[model samples]
Target chain A: MRRLSALALALVACGGGGGPTHVVSGVSPPVSAPPAAAPAPAPAPPPSEDASVEVGLGEARLCVRVGGHVHCRASDAHGERPLLEEPAVEGIDDAVSLSVGARHACAVLRDGGVACFGDNAHGQLGAGVGVASSPRALRVKNLASADRVVAGPLHSCARVGGGAVACWGENGEGQTGSSTHYAEAARELVVPTAVAGVSGAASLALSRSVTCALAGAGPVCWGRDTTQQPIQNTPPAAAPWLAGATALAGGGEAVCQATRDGTVACRGSGALVTSMGPVALPPMTSFGVGASHACGLLADRTVRCWGQNYSGQIGRPRSEIGTNVTVPSAVPGLPKIKALAVGGYGACALSLAGELFCWGSYPGAPREGGHEPSIVAIR
Target chain B: MRPTQIAAAVALALAALLDRGARACSCFGPRPALVSPGPDHPAPVTSRVRALVPIHRAAGATVVLRPPGGAPVAVATASRSMGGVDLVELTPSAPLAPDTRYEIALHSPGQYPSTFVFGTFRTGATRDVKAPRIDAIGVAGAHANPGAMSSMCQSADTVVTLDGISVSDPDRDGAEIALGVWIADAAGRVDTKKLPVYWAVPKNGHVQLGRTSICDPRELPLPNAPAVTLGVAAIDESGNTSPVKLVRVALPPARHP
Candidate 1:
């Protein structure tokens, strides 16, 4: 099988277009300023493309494998149409965890550093950072051992080494838990932490009002509890029916747990903003959250997703099947895959099969971050 | 008609007008008691219609028929029942359909087009319209996260199709299904007519739940964070409604699981 090449997105590629950035619902506007007059001018990157994955079913955008890196689309689609492509990131290069929010996204790199992109008026993309076009990563102050990142509409949270969770960005609804405006770095989250027993967990999940974590055979969550996500200093509890899980992801109003048992369990309200319904999946390894849907990794390394299949983040255009595909099903025609991640309206996945594939809208290269000009160094 | 009959009607009218005087102190004279026109009267007999107009103008005075639906008919404005009352007697030129939909407009002097009666009425029907059945129900679209609220819809189209459901008229003699909806939370309540309800896919796709609020009816903001219950029901022409269709959706389980 030909390993699908990774889809790379160069932020500068899609030069700033004056088109109306039509965003739906909670999406905010981009906040980063244009790069200083120097380096190079970014060209117009091609718009993202989507491929049909099922017959009489919706399509999937991102593909991924377990324990592998992920490739994602920089742009997100509106309805069935692709919006941006290979968009840029705002933080560090080596992201450890990634999540999408209402208008921005957050990433945690291996060095306990945080990066952000998309909208920043809420300071969601973080404070400092660089990149030609994509949001460049800015070093968050305070704690440096950040391990996980989760983004909500106006807020972002990270799980640090000591089971302490810190959140910043928009504090409008006190979504950051603390009644403060902004917290630059990793600090003790105001809400109770749910990772008590699991001392050093590798992952954490955040939704609009809640956050969750997985450690050993148990997972825990806290916060406003819209759906489910870990807050801080809480013990990991097993999802109601979910047994043996490896990874987890949280949406604005829903949560999905990818289990070591190979099955994914999704639980939440049936509200329009929430993705409800039981999604049956083939044995899978991991899962990621988009604005409204969740994508999972299959044993075959192919990606399968269910719930709010908007923006083709589930791997295909929802229009391909009318309504949303809320059932865990296959993303057809995808070659071997490794890791998968969903951001706002787009998706990215890396193929252990050696390739990276992305669909929906993101702001970069169509195939393998194309041999673009040398990346600019942003300090 | 005998003079005695005429005298009786006049007396009744006088009595009704006098009754109104006690309730509201207005410059206008007393109101007239409404008496059903007798069979002996001519086909288009004009009778003084007992009415009460505002010290200014009545807000929504309308001439409604007993039954609902039929060929378009006309009403002739006779004499003013009372001075400065702006109340005119209406004479239907044609016999209204028995137990069917009929309408009459209040002759507003130079305002909007003759204002038609809003609700339908049946002449002498026995039963009320039957309520439409509710089928599948669920929420669609993006999930409710922090700032946004979740939405859901109920499917009545299928039942409407199989049963030929139509809007019910309170005055209609027979049956007609009518739709009414309400949403409530720990804080307050909202109605379907108030909240935005969208047509589902396909024809009369019925109604799916939505968060968008419409004009006459609007959604009430969720007060206590995390959850709310939605209720929907249908009424029949007889003024009967089915048990409210109800469902509750919440971000956090009402009870810890």
Candidate 2:
């Protein structure tokens, strides 16, 4: 069985023109003056693309598992930017899976352990609130085994051994499967708490404050949806129209899933951002979601994206960057893909033969780091 | 517990204002008189915050609301950080009963303490459109004698304290006013920036002055200052403000002799 990868983002290939660096948040403006030899190709050798395992994108950074190790590069001055010099994450050796969030990142290890690093202000790092955030990754406590990990802006969750879903971090909207007072300190979860009532989960997706897990009981979701009435700390009703969800991905505005029947279903305020719910697209092998746009990998190895198109993330003409695409439009110029991810403001895909192609904000940010950012540099 | 007049908290506010005395006051009184619960006394109608903020950072204070003889309603409590004085929020498990008297109790520092009663939010509700006015400000510890209403009193060489400035919100008794205060020179110029904005809860319709004096001569080295005066203006949660009242300061008749 092929191990299907998930993380939908905008559609396209690298070098969609240097255009303009449009960062919604985190990526700071070029703080230092351009070095004497700035705006050239990457100073370091390009990543070994053939040996790559998986790729993860987030609010301000990117991560990839290569040669059984995890490496990441981030934007934001106080974020993981310092580690860009040596993108190999400071902790963990045998990382099996990788996931990134707004300002934090985490990976699942071969031994079924989990390590996270980045902002802890909302405890998204699992170090609890007020604990200083460091680039060094730290193991999440109380969990001896985890199958997969998913991280949202202010919180995160992991699939436990028995398929029991556990989550931590901010719970202002009770998004963590637990409730927290509105206070910052009260809302942070230093450790993961098992989300009751969810089991046998095959896929999960987390966004701003909404978390949806596709499990035996169907597609049940919880937390606060900016588009719906908040159902906190309680079992959120399953989306009636979203049964048999085989793959899941979410963005700031919505969550979409690829069902076993080969159709795609999406719901949330993003419907207003673009025409997202119950999209009539062809049978898809998998899909990835970015902040406000999403891309799907068709059985024939083509990519199509729709939704907020600012920065031309949906493969539309650069002139149509700010316009929204209601229809699933094809992302022109791409080879067959094995897996892909969406985050920050763009999308990237790993070709079947192991070549990497990214488009719409390639190598998202701290873009002015002397060397132009392109492929995920797996050292 | 009775609304005992223990002015220590005010002294702390005053001492804190002047970097002066420690808060020597402590009175565990009746539960909060349910006023509109915004971040810290704003408009009273948000469902998100069913809080009693009068506690004002009382250590380990817990607010519980219950129907008389009924089981305590579950509530979520937290200390809301409001720059000046952090306010505690108490979100009851459910909407409070209408026109009904619910008990508001402080579980900590127990004994003879009784829950407070807040029921005016009943009926169709007539909004208090009028901003409460300040009849006057009475000063204590300004020497044993005084002249006319506008006269500045004489004082001793060391400490001068203002118990609490009073306000009249006739629409409701026991009303609390968020007062903006500052020190001015006899010429009536006040450095609003260098002032302490405090709250005063009126009792018996009298100006229960609960703050410290702004006339700490050492702190106010105004060449034109011993004539340093006090400025008090009443502000309602609805962003209403009263005319500024300037009170002349009375320094000790004999200092640095």
Candidate 3:
């Protein structure tokens, strides 16, 4: 059987002729000098080809895939220079997928190679160095031809060739798939290590303390089980329910899987569902989970989300929509969504036309303004 | 034996076992060995005493310190658990007098009828003149790993580390001294937040403070700031404050490819 792949195309569009446009929204200015020479102008788009863009949310930065390159901006401090403009962020032209964690980000290149930047205190960058952090995209060691990459709060993992998974960074609760107790010593796993007992995996999903992979056998997860929640450190002996799951997604303390039958099974925080009860869900093609909320893209191209709606992450105010949406509700005022990405308290949807619309909150200052879906302009 | 007789015997045995368990007292610390003071053998003086006890059974326990010829000094207690060990720290409202003896007491209502004496320690000759020496101040990026992700959110500050700051005290044990830090950013904003300083027991002779990132509420936000200056001061047990020592750090310029 062909493996199910979360291969949604991210759209990118070049701006009209301009010198060097900088976009700032309560962020700080770039600390490094601008490039000595301007980059070559991007060619105009052909009528038949839509620009592809990939977006990832970090703790305080928003990364957008543009022209096969990834550019990032912060949402809190005041200044507006793209993080990719740094000299250290070279060889990002072939980035195919991007995953952003609390303080770092990783991009899967077209050749299935991986590179990461930002905080490396625990060596999340996978670079064999002692530096606490880096602005450059360091190539992940011993990892090549990765098809999918997911960045957890601290560690990062990638599904490499042969459906094998490799992980690095904090492994306190065995999140890195290493039995060694590193969290006790306050140490970190600096390089990607093969995840034991996991192969033929199609994709990986990470929460605060747990890592789950949709493998041939089923959705296998491991890591710290501090909450005694259904999402335990060890998979149940007999989990027929997980059979034939195509994709896995989670945030905060919850985990949800989309099955081939098009139904969704979620465990952890009950807030991810609606109060009306578990209604029959439409066949889903994609799924995204944030800290307290979850969203799914239907095969019909419509998007629906549930869980916490406090910040209007479900696309409406809590007054209009209740606090706990136990049932999946369609997100209003959105075009045909191609893909979706969820952050700590906010969610963003990429439209078929390559437009990005976000609701709730991203990294930065607290949510002070209205919580509504608004267009985010990217270059 | 009759069923009633057997049941009575089992109840008696269980009650005896619980009584023995309740009477077990496992407590230690206050460090430097609390003992009588002498001119040749002076005791280390501090306004606070930290005691290690069973965390689960310390709910109604109280600690008190009585100075010679003076009313009992007010003691505040705080409890914390680390590495499976629970610690209860007792801090006196005021420092003990120099060259004076103070009796320490622990009282648990149901566990002990009378106050349990923790022994007496005499304070040494006042050394309020010498303040703790600030050895060095070091800063590094916050530790980024999967475990730290739950609490931190994304922001422009993503590229910047939270700036973990470490300070060392040369005179007394690092934990014995109360240290306060002030951070000033390039924007000229000064934050005089009193950060917690933990003594490096295994490392010996060093104290560490601050988090991996400024996102922690206790840390001063220094995102994209080109430079920062930190001021540190040590407050002695006798309420003598040290002169502020300033350390200026020049951060790498923000990157723009």
Task: Highest lDDT: give the candidate number.
Answer: 3
**After superposing candidate 2, which stretches have Cα over 4 Å from the reference?**
A1-52, A76-85, A186-189, A225-237, A271-277, A320-322, A362-379, B1-257
- Considering lDDT, which of the candidate structures 2 and 3 is the better prediction for this target? 3
TM-score of each: 0.38, 0.54, 0.52
lDDT for predicted candidate 1 compared with the true structure: 0.37
lDDT of 3 at A14: 6
User: Compared with the true structure, what per-residue lDDT tens digits does model 1 show for residues B78-128?
Assistant: 333222222333445544444443332232333322232221222442433
Scanning candidate 1 chain A in windows of ten residues, the lowest lDDT window is A12-21
| Candidate models: Cα lDDT each | 0.37, 0.50, 0.51
- Evaluated on chain B only, candidate 2 has a TM-score of 0.38
Q: Once superposed on the true structure, which residue ranges of model 3 sit more than 4 Å away at CA?
A: A1-51, A77-91, A184-189, A225-232, A235-241, A273-279, A363-370, B1-257
Please give the distance, in angstroms, between residue B63's alpha carbon in candidate 2 and its true position after superposition.
Answer: 5.5
What is the Å distance of residue A328 in model 1 from its true position? Answer: 2.4
For candidate 3, the TM-score is 0.52
Q: Kindly list the per-residue Cα lDDT of model 2 for residues B1-257, writing each as its tens digit.
A: 01221132222222222222422322232223332222122232212222234434355555665543356667776553222333344555555444443444444332111222221122122234456677766763332222211112122233334445557666644344545455565578765433233334444533323212322111222223234466767654333456678766665453423
Interface RMSD of 1: 27.8
Candidate 2 retains true contacts at a fraction of 0.00
List ranges where model 1 is wrong by over 4 Å.
Answer: A1-102, A107-111, A125-136, A171-199, A215-218, A226-246, A259-262, A270-276, A316-320, A361-379, B1-257
